[model samples]
Target: MAKELQKLFEDLKREMKQEFRELKESFERELRKDVRDIKASMSFINQCYEEMKASVKKVEAENEALKESISTLKEEREALYAQVKEQESRLMQNEQHSRCLNVEIKGVPR
Candidate 1:
């Protein structure tokens, strides 16, 4: 009976060692998987950061283009204003010339 008890204890110890090894292996596998997941998540975050930076750059470029366009529009407006002023002066000169001709014609016999 003593020998049987010793055998049974030895078997139980072997089984427990096997179970412990299996648990250790499972824990290591899960740890490796979690590490891989973290790495993938970090990579995705980096990609998103890069994309956001590019988008910011694009927006900045657009803003600069808009500033240039606004400046050009302002210049065009000034040019148009100058043209309108010149046309107005020409019209006034033409009106004065027409009135002078009419007065001269009426002073003459017809």
Candidate 2:
């Protein structure tokens, strides 16, 4: 009877060890799957970040170009304004000279 009891204990120990090994294997597999999912998510986020950076760079370049164009237009406008001012001055001088040249005959009475 004692021998039989010892035999039974040994069998039970073997079975417990087998069950523990299986549980450990299942847990490891689940952990590995979670890690893979996390890696994939990180990869997608990195891709989006890179694309956004590129778009921002493009916008910055366009903005710089617009600034240059505005600066050039302002300079042209200033030059045109100067020309107009000169023309106005010439017109006023011409009118004054013409008035000076006008003569009323001494014998003419109004």
Candidate 3:
């Protein structure tokens, strides 16, 4: 009976060791999968960052171009204003000369 009990205990110990090994292997596999997922996530985040950086650079360039265009338009507007003033002065002089030429004598009957 003692021999039988010793054999049963040995069998139980072997089964327990096998179960522990399986559990350890499963844990390691899950850990490796988690690491791979993390790496993939990090790579995606880096790609997004690069795209955003490029977009920012493009917008900055466009902003500078717009500023230059605005400056050119401002200069043109100033020039047009000067032209309008010169034309107005010429028209006033012509009107004054015409008025002087058409003066009437007060005693003349129509």
Tens-digit lDDT string for candidate 2 (1-60)? 999999999999999999999999999999999999999999999999999999999999
Give the Cα-based TM-score of candidate 1 against the true structure: 0.74
Candidate 1 yields a Cα-based lDDT of 0.97
Global CA lDDT of candidate 2, please?
0.96
Off by over 4 Å in 1: 104-110
Taking the tens digit of each residue's C-alpha lDDT, what string does model 1 give over 42-73? Answer: 99999999999999999999999999999999
Best by TM-score: 2
Order of quality (TM-score): 2, 1, 3
Q: Write the residue-wise lDDT of candidate 3 on 1-110 in tens digits.
A: 99999999999999999999999999999999999999999999999999999999999999999999999999999999999999999999999988987967798779
Q: After superposition, how far is residue 74 of candidate 2 from its true place, in Å?
A: 1.4
Q: Could you tell me which residue pairs clash in candidate 2?
A: none
lDDT to native, each model: 0.97, 0.96, 0.97
